[model samples]
Target: MAKQFPHITDTHRDFIARQYVFFTASAAEGARVNLSPKPTNAFRVIGDNAVAYLDRTGSSNETAAHLLADGRLTIMFCAFEGAPLILRLYGQGRVLHRDTGEYKALLTDAFGEEPLGARQIVLLDVDLVQTSCGFGVPLFDYHGERHNLDRWAEAKGEEGLAAYRLEKNARSMDGLPTGLFSEEPAEADPA
Candidate 1:
């Protein structure tokens, strides 16, 4: 059975903090839905009705594109080791680019430090919170965080990363502009 709440409770926040990974889902009206698994350490609960996560550089910027087109977003967390619960946050999300003052403030206030390969911040104004019994979710043992992304980012450097973002992360697979590289025109074929 599932239960719904208007805001995230302390218990809910605790559950979220213990999770190792979460999933984000978004979509534009005419575009394919995007679902991505993200590390838990990158997420933070700002308030009972708000949450934010550091968006790392990826092959595609589908989440940013989808949010720009439509603000709808869903974030889900499941207990993979101890409790049997699945929690979800439903809200409108917006992307805060690294160039923005708000991003800098949030980087300092919320995240404590800017992470390597951090491209943008995704902030969600949550309207609904839900929890369900995740009886079927299997428990997995925790190992360690992967350092590959950090290594890749360090190797690319700032100029290379900016160029790569312009070349690759500026558009979604469905041809929607992500606004990552605002100086460049949106490419029809983001190949």
Candidate 2:
């Protein structure tokens, strides 16, 4: 069975909180589509009509680049155990890097003063919530989150990380702007 809703409710929020992983999808009008699985408690529901997720330090900035090029994005979550359900959040999304003053302040509120904690936070102003059968989704056992990424970033040091981003990030494969390096003061880290 499938159900559609106008916005996220308390029930939806509860479902969101229990998930261990979520998928983000975005694309430019005529460019490549981007979808990536995210973990590490990178997401949260800010209001009945909105959800936000931290775009942690990573290799490519496809989502951000696509959002900069096109504001549309989708976030999907599935339950692999207990019950079977697939939740899709449809909305327009915006990227707020460390350079974005307001977003940075929001991060400060969520986190703390040590601003170098995570990367950018992509806020999705959701317009619709859809739920569908996820019976096809395979059941998987819960183990633990890998600490390799965080450890690697910590070991690399800020300067090394910057060099790495410049080398790996900067633009989307389709040549769209990520606005990553555009904000000069903030170290260019494309999520």
Candidate 3:
């Protein structure tokens, strides 16, 4: 049975905070569905109905593009330890780019512009929340986090990172507009 909305309580937020990794899924109205795992502490609760995450530079930019077309975004946080729980936040998402006003407002003083490049501010307006058994998840020992991605971004710096996005993320793998690292989205001219 699906747990209905407004039934999820505050204790669920506590479960979310305890998660070290989560998965994000998104898709446009007419594009390939995107599902990826995020293993960093990139998300946080900002309100009873809203949450946000720092979108770092990555190989793909499907989430940003998908938000532009359709705001539907699903974030799943599984308790990989201690207890068994799979919490899914079903909601709409808005993408705030580095040049966008919302990005400045959401990230101001919340983080430092160091060690990595800032891509976008993804804010989710929760419409529903569900929790289920996560007994099938494999149990892995907590060792340590590898800083390779951070170090790679640091070494490349922001300028290089922008170029990387331009080269790899300007378009979706399905040849759809990604709207990332592009001077102007080619879709502007629908000719």
Query: In candidate 2, what are the lDDT values of residues 1-191, reduced to their tens digit?
Result: 98999999888888888889999999888798899999828787888888888776788889988888889999999997768889999999987877778777877776454333356788999999999989999998889898888788888878877887776667788876687786445657898
Question: Estimated TM-score per prediction?
Answer: 0.94, 0.89, 0.87
Candidate 3 local distance difference test against the native: 0.79
Sequence-dependent TM-score of model 2: 0.89
Expressed as tens digits, the lDDT of each residue in 30-127 for candidate 1 is: 99999999999999999999999999988889999999999999999999899799999999999999999999999999998786788999999999
What TM-score does model 1 achieve against the real structure? 0.94
RMSD of model 3, in Å?
A: 2.6
RMSD of 2: 5.3
Q: After superposition, which runs of candidate 1 have C-alpha atoms over 4 Å from their true positions? A: 183-191
Per-residue CA lDDT of model 3 for 48-135, tens digit only, reads: 7788888888888888888877889998888778888788888999877888766787787454452376687788899888877888
State each model's CA lDDT, in order.
Answer: 0.93, 0.82, 0.79
Clashes of each: 0, 0, 0
User: What's model 3's lDDT at 20?
Assistant: 77
Candidate that scores best on TM-score: 1
Positional deviation of residue 112's Cα in model 2 after best superposition, in angstroms: 4.3
